[model samples]
Target: MSRLRPGLARVEFYAVWNEVSELLNQGHTYRSAYEFLSEKKKITMKYDSFRRHVKAQFAKKKFMEIDSQEKSVIPADNKPKRVVPATATVQAFDSKNAVPLSDLLTEE
Candidate 1:
């Protein structure tokens, strides 16, 4: 059986998460900010939990913008075909009619 009084869960921190993120994004290290808040009785979660939550929030905001050249009709998970000019010719391998390397090179 648990011998603890009623308290808020970690999810409760989301209520003011944006504010916390803003504060941290303003050149404040997690350790210093967390320690200050912890000492001031403003934060209840442990340092590890605080850091994890902060990192998760930050990771969510990161993303890459795909250019028109890289974009395709295919699904985002699937790699798109390489883009080339219309004048470009696609070549195929011909093992039976291979060119000899000696014929292409001659001492001038």
Candidate 2:
């Protein structure tokens, strides 16, 4: 069923989203940001809703940063590849390469 959008929905925020984020990122308090923005343009959303909506932007920005960092970290196999430095040689060792306990206990 088609329904009419709410008053807040009628407010076009995408155009000013960047400015809103910049204001918050500059360390302005939510109250100050809300007040400042509301004065510049009519904001229908209540102060509390404005605070939550703006904070959600911060959360989204944080999440995106963490997600991008995670993407750059670790290979698909889950094991990180090591760079071979000339100072030291890396070796892969397993149980098959280990000396038997009996051999260690017995002296030739």
Candidate 3:
């Protein structure tokens, strides 16, 4: 039977995880961040797990930031604006005959 704890509480690792994520965003490689956390901070976890957590945290942060920006930029007026179509010629040419080079090049 494996001795590893199946349900490790994330609350215990939150601070260390945030630190690791910040280091990663500052251009630290996973290996470097792992070493720093393991040796200096005395935080221990599987390298793969740490890496995945850091990536997920960063992705979540980025997504939240983007969502906030989108929300702020959107106008308060919720009414839908009417869309006006452009006035353009809709021409249908006979497909049976090969189109002439000059006809094809001219703007309608």
TM per model?
Answer: 0.46, 0.55, 0.57
TM-score between model 2 and native: 0.55
Count backbone overlaps in model 2.
0
> In model 1, which runs have C-alpha deviations exceeding 4 angstroms?
1-9, 63-108
Q: The CA-based lDDT of model 3 is what?
A: 0.73
Residue-wise C-alpha lDDT for candidate 2, range 1-108, written one tens digit per residue:
233266443254555677777887899888887788778864645676677777677798899999999988957788767997687667877888899889889964
Q: Of the candidates shown, which would achieve the greatest TM-score relative to the real structure? A: 3
Native-to-model Cα distance after best TM-score fit, residue 56 in candidate 1, in Å:
0.8
Question: Candidate 1's residue-wise lDDT over 1-108, tens digit each?
Answer: 222233342563575577577668797788877876667767677677778877776676552234443465557878668997688676898878987777678632
Q: lDDT values of the candidates? A: 0.66, 0.71, 0.73
lDDT of 3 by residue, 1-108 (tens): 223365352433576776776787899999898888878845566677677767777799899999999999998996689999898988777768767788878944
Worst 10 residues of 2 by lDDT: 1-10
Q: State, as a TM-score between 0 and 1, how close model 3 is to the true structure.
A: 0.57
Using lDDT, give the best candidate's number.
Answer: 3
Of the two candidates 1 and 2, the one with more favorable TM-score, higher being better, is 2
